[model samples]
Target: MDSPWMKRSRRALELRDGFPRLMAVLNKRKNFQTIPSEVSSST
Candidate 1:
């Protein structure tokens, strides 16, 4: 939606950083890291 929505979403979330940060760090579906990983092994 808008910038405000993004920031508010971050604050409201029980988790932190990820969902809101995705707007920047997320490039493709394959680029996302969802669970615990070996850094080079999963995501």
Candidate 2:
């Protein structure tokens, strides 16, 4: 069985590893949204 401290540490590690991936996905979505709008406005 895992200790509570171990569980908390593991959870923290998971969040740390996942944070960049989450940021990258959010950035990609933002770019996807802006690119089309910019193109439409220019043309």
Candidate 3:
């Protein structure tokens, strides 16, 4: 018999695996937004 808790825990593990990649993409987007302004100011 399949347990609901087991299914939930499996889903949680999948989310944990993917969360870092998601954060990296978000951080890249944040850096992309800031870099242009910094370059413009420096030039």
TM-score, per-candidate, Cα-based: 0.26, 0.52, 0.44
Using TM-score as the measure, name the better of candidate 1 and candidate 3: 3
Tens-place lDDT digits, model 1, residues 1-40: 5699887766557335455655344444346655323323
List model 2 lDDT by residue over 1-43, tens digit each: 9999998899788868877985676688788774445324532
**Which pairs of residues collide in candidate 3?**
none
RMSD for all candidates, in order, please. 10.9, 12.1, 12.5
The deviation in Å at residue 35 for candidate 3 is 23
Scored by Cα lDDT, where does model 3 land? 0.68
- Stretches off by above 4 angstroms in model 1 are 14-43
Clashes of 2: 0
Candidate 3 lDDT over 1-43, as tens digits, reads 7699998888678768877985686578788774445423632
Please report how far candidate 2 places residue 34 from its true position, in Å: 16
True lDDT of residue 18, candidate 2? 78
Work out candidate 3's RMSD over C-alphas.
Answer: 12.5
lDDT of 2 at 8: 89
Worst 10 residues of 2 by lDDT: 34-43
